[model samples]
Target: MTIQSLGVGSGLALDDLVTQLLSAEREPKEKRLNDKEERIEAEISALGQIKSKLSDFKETVDEMRRDSDINGREPTITHPSEDKDIFTAEASNSALRGSYEIAVTELASGSRIETADAAYTESTDQVLTDGLGSTTMTFKINNTGDSFTVSVTQNMTLAQLREAINNNENNFGVNANIIDTGTATGGAKLVFTSDVTGAGNDLVIVNDGDRAELDSLTTTDSTETATNLSPVKSATNAKATIDGIPVESETNEFENTIQNVSFEATSVSPLDTDGITRVTSTLEIGYDRDGLDKKIRDFVDNYNKIISDIQSLTRYGESDLEEDGALAGDSMLRGISNGLASIVGSSVDSSSLGGLFALGVELNSDGKLEIPTTDFGLGTGDERLEAALEDNFDEIAKLFTDEDQGIAVRLYEMANEYTSYSGLITLRERAAKDDKDQIADDRERFELRMVSYEQILRDRYLNLDQTVARLNQTGSALLAALG
Candidate 1:
């Protein structure tokens, strides 16, 4: 009764016709917008990848700028005798390269004290301080006169006192623990150890109150009335000699005793037992050539990786699919590539080693940097690098670390320009995102217009169908009268 049977009156496929017309108008615009969106997305992805590569390149450059870089002076240590556990040493770049004799006479030790074996029992619920009136226990370290206090309260167990002392905020350089002997005669003993090692740094306990319970916990040396605690070990300073010159330290580890050289006294020299009392160990400090070589090689490898990524992204190909590299024709990529190449190819001023090419790094036919293992008829490549490092070491370091014209410094600065928060890459990405947003807005408006156009087509067709039905009815009535 309604428009369901209207197709017969109109003699035309109205629904299909309207659909075809609307699709024809919408399809092309939608396809164009979708293609633009995809291109912008691809560009954003490409920028992210480029930024990552630049950051990696910057890391290598930063290493080269440091004084501790492998390209700089490297120190190597050699011990003359094997199995000399008496001592071990490390030399820094600041250390003068020389040979020195060392002797370890004694290793430093910490102060240790144990409470009298009868002080505590294995029973957890037994309160040792029940009868002990409130008292103040003071601990001093290093004879510094700086002390920490522990207030012993009534009804406190031996375990509780240990925890209170350990958890005290003011307590420094001391640790307390409860040791259970598990024997009837030796129930439990509280032990205290000085965290610091050295001759003058000793743990001293003093009881301030008249409480006998607190006085019993102090060592005999600190209090005459103290008989419940005994000193098991005395704090002692480490003793050693460099080239027969005596040296003393609070700890076994000796620092700056030999001009930028630090060492730890592990055990007494074996020569002491033989009655020789002479140097037990000899130390040699020198330049590490192999270490520097490995570092330079790693820097070259990281540089090449960055170059390869840039080349891949900017390359052009014949086929459509193969030619779709996101940054193929990007001007920003071109500028970045040119800037890096210029910096690498430039020379540092006031340096005997002019540039990387003179010191083993060379650009190949493929536009990538490579370090050849063997010299290919040119005396200027890998062989030159080794000779320069061995013969003119200072010049090689100056070439890469020169403050004004160093290649590493310039390259690091250049990378920062593109990778920084407000850099070129970030700006380009922002522009691309804006373009995508505009395209999305356009698509939304187009869809809305199509919806309104579709309704117009449906209204016009419905009116046409009704008008054609009325005309058919009139003609049938006329034919009936004529017959």
Candidate 2:
């Protein structure tokens, strides 16, 4: 049987004493390991916050690098005398500033044709050709004479014929449909329309079968046929004039007709007393000032947010009772903050727009940036940035986007150094994780050693208890012998 405890025979608290001795040695060591682990974990979390802030700041800088980025170009249009509903225009980055007189003479039209009424009296499933030979139908567009052919075999229904024409691989610029007139004699009719809109791009359908049989099914003439299959609409080109110069387009929308400007003619111009169209509308393209200002303001707001975050993380408290931030006194944070400030203050040699200061962006006492409403001793007025842009458009553009010297370019390059896969932030996080793992390993080894040490102390105390019991029994035997 196992003994209850080492102190049972000796009548002393040997187990309690051993536990007290071992705890004295283990508590301090365990606390040290725990403290180290806590510090490493805190560092890892702080680095993650830094990485997130840097990423947001980088996005703002990237916007300044490309022409299509935020506030890159703003184009506006003003019409003097015409209704905007009649026509509308849009301008691209390449559009030049100018005013032009535009007169819409005509709008483009597409070709539409419908078959004669009652083209199919039988059910939709009935064979279209009876027992006769196959019938071949040809379709042409734009009078080019290049045709696509559709063949109808015996036992094919009118519905099947519609599907065959649409599924034909050679068919181009034309589509067919079946329309029901809801009458006994005019049961159903087949219609065809040209996808393209132009003067000559008409849908011409001709059948190579018997004239009477083919005429009952489809029509090729411009006028109404006996089968009721006739042209409902004719193809026509769009006509307009730019500055008294006539221009023709296959569609109502015209692109690149006058530099980078594109316009769509939605309605015909009002006519004069002589039955000729004479109305003209003025088209103007210019820079959008409000849009550019909004972009600049957004950049300032984002920069300020980053600055506030860094400052909070690295600030030292004023008193002992005040707690310090997780990353207080961190050298990495200091380096990043200084580097961004330097880039913003440095001037670019490629443009007259020196730096952010010249652009009306100033750092406040709190280390955050702001766009001031009034001039900061700069000769330019309260709206200095806007004035600069209006006067020196090219120089302002170069200041933000120059190849190697631009402020935006330099900031982007610095951000990549901290956020890349092999960046300093990534390496620091990895090192902290390794230190935490080592502390865990040490704690496990210490616990195992404590278990062995406790067992050794119990064995030594058990031997001492046995020796004291024997001595007590010997004393009792001597007292009885003397009595």
TM values, all candidates: 0.85, 0.81
How well is each residue in 106-132 modelled by candidate 1, as lDDT tens digits?
888888998776766753533435565
- Pick the TM-score winner: 1
User: Model 2: residues >4 Å from true position, as ranges?
Assistant: 79-84, 103-105, 117-127, 132-153, 163-175, 181-187, 203-234, 264-282, 374-376, 379-382, 460-483
Score candidate 2 by TM-score against the native.
0.81
- CA lDDT, candidate 1, residue 44: 85
Residues 1-483 of candidate 2: C-alpha lDDT, one tens digit per residue: 234787776678888888898899789998998888888888888889888988888888888765545324344444434345557887776677788888889999878987666766533844354567687777777466657888878777878888988999988867778878778798777778877688877777776564445665556532333332557898989999988999988899988897787899888777666887667777777765566667677877887777777888888898999867778989998899889888877888988878776667777677677767764467433367777667765566567788788877888889889988999888988888998899889988999999988888777887877777677668889999999
Report every candidate's CA lDDT: 0.76, 0.76
Positional deviation of residue 218's Cα in model 2 after best superposition, in angstroms: 6.2
